[model samples]
Target: MKAPSTHPIKPATSIPALLKTAFVNALIALVLFSLMIGIRTEAGSSGQLTYWTRFGDLASIVAAVFGGSIVIELLRQWIGPTGAEKLVPPAVQSGISFIGRYLAPALLIFTLLVPVMFYNQRYILDLAILVLTYVMLGWGLNVVVGLAGLLDLGYVAFYAVGAYSYGLLATNFGWSFWICLPLAGILAAFWGVLLGFPVLRLRGDYLAIVTLAFGEIIRLVIINWQDLTGGPNGVSGIPRPSFFGIPLDNSDDGLAARLGIEYSPTHRIVFLFYLILALALLTNWATIRLRRLPIGRAWEALREDEVACRALGINTTTTKLTAFATGAMFGGFAGAFFATRQGFISPESFTFQESALVLAIVVLGGMGSQLGVALAALAMIGGFELFRSLESYRMLVFGMAMVLIMIWRPRGLIGHRAPTVYLTKAQAISSDLVKEGHG
Candidate 1:
């Protein structure tokens, strides 16, 4: 390790020293509260939200900055350096450990308990289902953003295509849900390819702008194609999911009777919970498997350095197409599931905000890290939900929070430790034998 003296603490310096400085500064900021209150007292107007008024905002900003600074200093002291230089636990192997250690048992136990839990407590069950659905979406997006390093801003379009496709197919052609489901995926995949062709040469900001435009175009089409999509009125009374051949309606021989449970509307919620939970797990497993494959390696290589990937003879075109297709497929699946859950489909549901939310999950979680994506999704999505009860100021607080988080974590929540596949330990050790002998 380089001596702390090598870069001695001065105007800018060591982490431990930084932490001590931050702690001192925070105390100073905290002591300024008396002056903040004085300013607020003078700035308070005849009719305005004290919180929204300039004085209140200054106080809040000062508090948030100083508070954030103290926390940042603590973290910096604990985990020093920056960029790729900062050490982190490996994403993939650590994800395996996390799932095998905590998530698997938690899922199994929750699955066993939710039936009883829902019977007694329904709202929590509903929230659980929503979280699971988003988790599925996040995992699917992970395949595109995390592993492939593609930035898609219009992902919600695939979702819309899936939902609307299912809605129209089932309503118009009397197709089965299963049939419509796969058909929806195929339609979305087709659109994904359609999108892939135009933006084949684009990356970074150009790619993002193109995708954002694509998403808006899809939403506009849905809005303009009023007759088919039901316009802003939305398609209601969409069919719910079913077993192999039986529906979950209030019929004589539906799921309620089979499970020996009384029929309440909540049974639909329970069914959805299990369905989404299963889908999320499936998405996770498939992504893990794909990352170990040759094509997956090509995607990661392309992500890190497209020119170098080309040098290695990997076809960038095929890699990009596959990434788009895989991500769109999952988004479509989510759309179908959402339609089934709410029994509704509307253009409003597939807005840019939804795309922004999913993209935010990918970034906040750390690019190319599956577990990080899931964790980030849960934190950000659930945090948004929690803030819902904050009334008119909710969005204000939420936006500010995002700004602060990005400032504090410029790279991401987990930074540069993206997951990847490597040789087995025995192979690694054997390869290192000569180097070890030289050392």
Candidate 2:
């Protein structure tokens, strides 16, 4: 055949391809970043628009996009297809597991000593409190979405109910935080059951829409029922949590005075930080324990395939309802803690954005992975704090980080799943194995 096929057919790597990708990326940056980040507007004293053009911001973003495109093109040319699957080396997997084994304890120790280490830094304590709140919320949602695969976008409604329950009970009825906490959880669980009954037949996008609508309904009811909810003004002067009978305020018989210690403003913040930490830890513990139980297994089975679960004689309705109730209970607990921390309850605080962020944390951490949830909450919430100086750009960076994480680890950061009860030896299972169905 004249040795025509002696040479291999190599794909051409053209400059035009690279340039085209670069151009497209640059154009996207221009549309998204140029007009938005490049243009800064503030309300002037005259109540008019005061514009400040930030050409440098636009230039930097464009340059970054162009450079990033070149690198991506190079990677494509050299590596070709990434393949549908990745096979991580055994050593690497073992090393990762080793590090993970110690990471949680290390984080716990660090958190425990943070108050002593940064005793005077009230900001650190406040930030810790905020992060832990999200952590608890993530774990709560994990039960419904991660375990049961319910896709609840209105989880924040339960959170709001818990918070408002505590606020109203503490302010209007003079109930203690300890008492309202459980009651709030019970009430939220009841609502969850109500929600579950309505969405029993819904799935996927339909389920999402119904949950979203439910959340908006709660917020609207709280707003229009001004006589009870205080409307948009919100309920303020909500009592703070007490240590036994001792308050952490500046009063004469408060915690500081009772303990005969020098009063410091950071004390309350530190207490709140530790309080949330304990609550988050409790959520983690409960979730982990539940994962080993019969109901938890049912939840996982339902998540993997509702049809198969029902075919196997599993009661799908009870499974879904229990998942919702359990998840809502945890959300309520976190909400009550939030009310105590803020000492205020408002309809604005329970927006769709909060639900989305909590859901994001659970998803980014790896569905049904408690440790993953904690790490994700830390990264996402702490990333926001790190970019506080960037102002509006913080959200931009946050969005980019989430996008990159999803691209790199589509399943999640720690996507490996271990079977609840092993046959021979307990082994870590690749998430890929269960992407289509149950492991």
Which candidate number would show the highest lDDT if scored against the true structure? 2
Q: Which candidate number maximizes TM-score? A: 2
**Each candidate: how many clashes?**
1, 0
| Model 2 per-residue lDDT tens digits across residues 343-372 | 888999999999999999999999988889
Task: Give the CA lDDT, 0 to 100, for residue 245 in model 1.
Answer: 65
- Quantify all predictions' global Cα lDDT against the true fold: 0.74, 0.88
Residue 144 lDDT in candidate 1: 77
lDDT score, residue 94, model 1? Answer: 62
Single out the weakest 10-residue window by summed lDDT for candidate 1: 430-439
Clashes of 2: 0
In lDDT terms, how accurate is model 1? 0.74
